[model samples]
Target: MWSWVLHRITGVAIFFFLLVHILDTALVRVSPEAYNAVIGTYQTPIMGLGEVALVGAIVFHAFNGLRIILIDFWSKGTKYQKVMFYVVIALWVITMLGFTPRHLINVFSH
Candidate 1:
């Protein structure tokens, strides 16, 4: 139940992130200075934290997608759905734990 809700939420968040990413990248072709100005804002500590959230969302979404695929394809998938959900969560936590500190250091050191 919660997994379904979170998967949908993360998917929407990722979609919006991609939309913004595309628009920002396109800015370079339209005007280099404007693109640079936009990118400069991303260097802030706040944006750095946003990047952490983005990575967390992506990791969770990806792992949860794989869990969904297993649920659909494996014969015993339904039987172990709850366990698989936990595995997805564990993987997401480990990944974020590894990423957040290094990212914060780089963000703050700059």
Candidate 2:
């Protein structure tokens, strides 16, 4: 139940980020000035936090979805679902810890 809820939440979050990313890239076609402005906003603290959340959502969704796929394709995965769940959590934590600071620093330093 918790896994289902988390999968839905992360999937929705990733979809939302994808929409914003598409719009932002499309703005480049509309106007370079507008695109630069949008890009400039990424340096802000709020957007930094959003970036962290975005990375987390993407990582979680990808890893968990892979787990789900393995389960669907093979019965062996059912026995290891609980272990995989912890692996997913660990991966999420490591990804965030390693990437978030670098991402924020790059955004701000630019």
**For candidate 1, lDDT tens digit of each residue in 38-67?**
999999999999999999999999999999
Question: How well does candidate 2 match the true structure, expressed as C-alpha RMSD?
Answer: 1.7
In angstroms, give how far residue 28 of model 1 lies from its true place.
1.0
Q: Candidate 1: deviation at residue 80, Å?
A: 0.7
> RMSDs, each prediction?
0.6, 1.7
lDDT per residue (tens digit) for residues 1-110 in model 2:
68779999989888888899899999999999999999997778888878788788889888889889877887899999888889988988998899988988886785
List the candidates' TM-scores in order. Answer: 0.98, 0.87
Model 1 residue 36 lDDT? 98
TM-score of structure candidate 1: 0.98
Model 1 RMSD vs true structure: 0.6
* Candidate of highest lDDT: 1
